[model samples]
Target: MARPPLRNDLIEEITTRVLDGRLAAGARVNEVHLARELSVSRTPLREALIGLAGRGLLTAEPGRGFLVPPFDPDEARRLYTLLAELEALALRWTSPLELAGLPDAVDAVADEMVAALERGADLSEVDDRWHALLLSRCPNPHLLRLIEQTKPLLKRYEWCYFGGVPRAGESIGEHRRIAAALREGDLSAASAMLVRNWVSTVAFLRKDNGDQCASE
Candidate 1:
């Protein structure tokens, strides 16, 4: 079963705050203040904090409650690496027939992403939809769950490095190429593109962070 709507909404709201740095890393969450600010109650707010903790966005202490975890660039790169590997596994396990009918959904989401980019609007939700559709052909529930688990951490890196940048335009082209490859039943090509997409994302983030490993 899905989480309650209030809990889910609180979770998303808190996540956005964390990703965009409104809730800075290492900052302690004042439950009362946050609940009043968000117009939510303690129960759902606590549930949201617990959910975020599970997603690696928050550290929950027995007496101190929750605090945003410090963003570690190396750890972010490692998470992206893991995400790429799991997504590649999904592509490998998905047969051509499983994806023959899914390109339309992927393309539609890509179109929305493009529109959002052109309008200088937030593309996070559309970007999520695009990737979710791209991997919908994968039949492994565990792989899917793992992919979902890494998204919050990945999005924090994205917000830190890619926000207000034109990265989405290039990403749309990559998305199209992957979708086209999948439509042609070229699993290898599609999987390669998916991995490249994620690897390139890590590279870009590293460069933005001025990491020595960016050249590596």
Candidate 2:
């Protein structure tokens, strides 16, 4: 197969497994196994691994190749705190900027979330897409890049963290509240909401897991 297509397919498979928590945090990975499972050669698998390491989705050791990055509770909390401040800043800064067509773009995520929950679905795709879209609205490329790095790392323990949902309808409530705040140019409330939402999200996700880490 062509390098580009083969690379894409392998990346998709790897991403799906990771997001689904099938590839657990700190889990060992085997290139040969991945190659066989993906029905591709090691060359493409190696290339995908290289790119993923650069993306901070995996830790690339000199001899270890690719390992699921460690899931440290303290580290995660610190990262979440940083993200909250960053998001607060982003929300404040992003409030006045006019996004002519952004309302529809964001509402699409809300729509998907509602539809997914109605069907008793995972809604991970809806969640991730909404996250990326909202983060992209931040003016600084560096801020966006920082969030991009953080999200993938947190996704490993995501399932064990969130596990399941009771009233999935609540997912869209924040979406509506945030959107309404953004529409009214209420930067202060929006910023506080961003901080509160993410800070609570980390605690909510960690509640059931009880900080399942070696250090803890």
Off by over 4 Å in 2: 1-12, 39-44, 95-112, 135-139, 163-171, 206-208, 211-216
Per-prediction TM-score: 0.78, 0.72
All models, RMSD in angstroms:
4.9, 3.8
Query: How would you encode candidate 2's per-residue C-alpha lDDT over 1-216 as one tens digit per residue?
Result: 444446767766787676665675677778888777777778888888887878777778887778877667666666668777876776555636653335567778889888888888888778778766776666788777677666666665455456345434555777767767767767677567767666666655554364565322
Question: How accurate locally is residue 38 in candidate 2, as Cα lDDT from 0 to 100?
Answer: 74
Candidate 1, lDDT over the whole model: 0.80
For each candidate, what is the lDDT? 0.80, 0.68
Screening candidate 1 with a backbone cut-off below 3 angstroms (N, C-alpha, C), the clashing residue pairs are none
Each candidate's number of clashing pairs is: 0, 0
Which stretches in model 1 have alpha-carbon errors above 4 Å? 1-9, 36-47, 162-166, 206-216
Q: Give the best candidate by lDDT.
A: 1
**CA error at residue 38 for candidate 1, angstroms:** 5.0
